[model samples]
Target: EDQVTQSPEALRLQEGESSSLNCSYTVSGLRGLFWYRQDPGKGPEFLFTLYSAGEEKEKERLKATLTKKESFLHITAPKPEDSATYLCAVQERKTSYDKVIFGPGTSLSVIP
Candidate 1:
């Protein structure tokens, strides 16, 4: 069975601190990887989409990178407004269609 796992169930960082969140997966055939951010009482917001290994995407203070079996979300100099739950999802090719697998998510709190 294909599975996605995220580490550090929760993280607290001071404003302007930098850190990286991890997402690891096991799948038969990978199609794509996705990153999302969800604030309290809100739906997940798309952050990045990675198609192949060594691919990287960046937006604002966040950067997403992918490898053969893992993905990383690096946040540089985060702010209080950046507090949210980061989600990692993977799309794997199955027999007839693509299956999207989501990790439990890492809740991040940035304090001022």
Candidate 2:
């Protein structure tokens, strides 16, 4: 069975603070790892895609990296506007149909 877990289900940070959110997983075969940000009452916005181990992607104050069994999202100098729920998802190569398993997100709150 494939399973994904995230730590510190919620985070509270002062403006300009930096932190890293962790996502650990176990899958039969990993095809891709994805990162997304979701705002209240909105759909998730794609942040990054990692195809293989050691792959990484970055956008503004966010960086996403992948490994054999886990992934990380590093937030640098976050502002109040950066507050959102960060999501981690994975695609399994063994599945016949395109199926992505998502982890419960890490909700981040940045206080100004």
Candidate 3:
């Protein structure tokens, strides 16, 4: 079975603080690693897609990197508006594109 687990169910950070969250995955064959940011009561917004090891992608305040066994999401100088649930999902070779699974997520709060 393919599985993804995220650590630190919740994180509280003062404004402008930086931190990194971990996403550990176990899959038969990893087809894609996806990162999403979801706000309360809203659907997730796609952030990055990492395919191979040593690959990294970045956005405004977030960076995502992938390795053989896990992925990391680094937040740099987060702001109040950056507070949200960060989700990591993986599509295995056995799973179809329409049947992607998601991790519970790491809820982050940036206190102003």
Candidate 4:
């Protein structure tokens, strides 16, 4: 079975504070690792796509890295607007490419 789990269901941070959340996974033949940011009542906005281990991507206050077994999303100097649900997904080698699975996500709040 394919699965992805994230730690610290919710994280509270002050403005300019930095931290990282973890995404653990167990999947058969990973094709891609995806990171997304979602706000309330909206679909996730794709951030990064890690295709292999030791790969990394970044944008503004967010950085995503991938490993053989898991992925990490690091938030640096987060602002209040950066607060949202950080979602991690994995695309496995399935019969259909649309069968991507997502983690529950880490809800983050940045206090100004």
Query: Which of 3 and 4 is the better model by TM-score?
Result: 4
Off by over 4 Å in 4: 95-98
Q: Give the per-residue lDDT of model 4 (tens digit) for 2-111.
A: 79999889999999999999999999889899999999999999999999999999998889999999999999999999999999998888675546899999999999
Model 2: per-residue lDDT, tens digit, 1-112? 7888997799999999899999999988888989999999999999899999998888999999898989999999999999999999998876467678999999999999
Q: Candidate 1, after superposition: displacement of residue 32 in Å?
A: 0.3
Query: How much is 93 displaced in model 2, in angstroms?
Result: 1.7
Error of 1 at 91 (Å): 0.2
In candidate 1, what are the lDDT values of residues 1-112, reduced to their tens digit?
A: 6799998899999999999999999999999999999999999999999999999999999999999999999999999999999999999998988999999999999999
Write down the lDDT of every candidate, Cα atoms only: 0.97, 0.92, 0.92, 0.92
**Index of the highest-TM-score prediction:** 1
Which residue pairs show backbone clashes in model 4? Answer: none
Which segments of candidate 2 are over 4 A away from where they belong?
A: none
User: Which 10 consecutive residues of model 3 have the lowest summed lDDT?
Assistant: 92-101
State the RMSD for candidate 3: 1.6
**How big is the positional error of residue 81 in model 2, measured in Å on the Cα after superposition?**
0.7
Report the lDDT tens digits of candidate 3 across residue range 18-83.
999999998878878999999999999999999989999999889999999999999999999999
CA lDDT, candidate 1, residue 48: 97
| Candidate 3 segments whose C-alpha is farther than 4 A from its true place | 95-99
TM-score of 2: 0.95
